[model samples]
Target: MSTLYLLHKPYRMLSQFTDKQGRATLADVITVPDVYAAGRLDYDSEGLLLLSDDGELIHRISHPRHKQPKTYWVQVEGDISEAALKSLRQGITLKDGPTQPAKARQIAPPASAPRQPPIDPKRHPSTSWLELTISEGRNRQVRRMTAHVGFPTLRLIRTAIGPWQLDGLAPGEWRTETLHAPRPTDKHPNRRKAPRKDQRARPAAKHRKP
Candidate 1:
């Protein structure tokens, strides 16, 4: 039995327990010990971040190799056009690399409360909003990809990660639930296998071996 928490991390909150400058962290919001964040949302970003006591679950959720899809609502620094939307879906090249093709589309303004310090008002003329879903989690990837297409992200909120969603969680709030671990026979079990003992001990038996 593992303890799983769906936390809505507020803006300016650190993902980890400790900060050199004594900033806010999961410790301030969640009292549970030995629980670690599965993936990270930047301090300036908001939304669902999974926390758990099970190390294997953490690895499964956070590691890119697992291919968990994350969905985000991003407010960018310009009105998004169909051309921009197409570019995003096709994949955009960033300084790091070409982002994996993403599912992107225009979306109605989100229903969340207004940001405390609202996004820059001066940029309102240029800003627009979109929803993007990507299976890969790279450092600041969403912001970078949007910027690469000439729309710098003004605000970012992750709305979903795989099967979990932000749902009713409010900013700075957290809820714990029992997450059933996928069994060996479950769909998409980690499939890499170790080599057999004989296979490891013996050299290549092929006729073309050097």
Candidate 2:
């Protein structure tokens, strides 16, 4: 059995258990014995964060090879244009390299709890909401992608990861569930089976009266 913790990581909190600078961290909200965060939300980003004692779960969520989809509701400065949305759908070229194409669409404001320190409206007098889903987890990839597309992200909130969602969770809150088995789509990694030998029974040679 695996122990998994679903946390609504508040903005400005580190995804780690502890921070030397005494800044906010997962330790402040969750008190489980040995669970660690799966992947991570940036220090300034907020929304669903998955934590677990299971290493396989952590790898599936964080490893880019799996191409697990992570979706975010991003608030960006200025009105997002169809062209910009199209670029995001195509892919962005960052300093590192070209990113995998993403699922990008403009969206109405999502209903959710406000950040502890809300993004200043004055700073972003004109803003638009967007739902972006990406499979690669480059560092600050969402922010970079949106910026490259001409709309600087003002506030970012992850809404879902693969089969998991931020639903029913609030900032600084957490819940636990014991997974008896992986979710259907998240079943164990596949491995080819070795070929089986013939299973047919041959008729015994009639008792040759030797």
Candidate 3:
């Protein structure tokens, strides 16, 4: 059986287990071994992060092609207009590539606990909060998407990832959950089948020229 951990990562903590500068990491909080993060959360962002001991489970959870929804509570620098929300839903093009169409909507203020250091006050006397849910997990994606639409995000907190949520978990805390075997219909057709358990654990190394 595989082990799945749902971690509520606090702001300013590295996602990986190790940091050369002695910053906080999962290793500092989680005592489990051989578990790896399914996806990444930026050091400045706070919220749910999933980890698992099974490599196949990791890929299934975080791979963009799987189309798992990730919901973020974003506080932006200016009042978000209806046009901005529409643009986000239609999908804003980023420098790297066009984002997949997303579900963007203004939300009532969330009931999350206060951050240790609150978001900075807007210099221009404008700010708003909105909820954004996207299936793709691009690097700093929620921040970039909002900025592209002229409402730069001031603070970002991920509220959920797929079926997992940050409901009872507090900042910097973690809990484990049992994941059921994927049903035949639940698996993504595009994803290649994972190697059998008896196969070599390591993926084939790619050759790079010096």
User: Once model 3 is optimally superposed onto the true structure by TM-score, how far is the C-alpha of residue 3 displaced, in angstroms?
Assistant: 2.2
What TM-score, over all chains together, does every model reach? 0.84, 0.85, 0.83
lDDT of 2 by residue, 62-149 (tens): 6666677999999999999999999999987999999989999999988989776777878778999999999888899999999998
Rank by TM-score, highest first: 2, 1, 3
Task: Identify the candidate with maximal lDDT.
Answer: 2
lDDT tens digits, residues 122-196, model 3?
A: 564767889899988778889999999999988788888877888867887788777677511336545544533
Instruction: Show the lowest summed lDDT stretch of 10 residues, model 2.
Output: 192-201
Clashes of each: 2, 0, 0
User: What TM-score, to 2 decimals, does candidate 1 have?
Assistant: 0.84
The lDDT of each candidate is: 0.76, 0.78, 0.77
Q: Please estimate how well model 1 matches the true structure, expressed as its whole-model Cα lDDT.
A: 0.76
Comparison by TM-score, 2 against 3, better one: 2
The better candidate by lDDT, 1 or 2, is 2
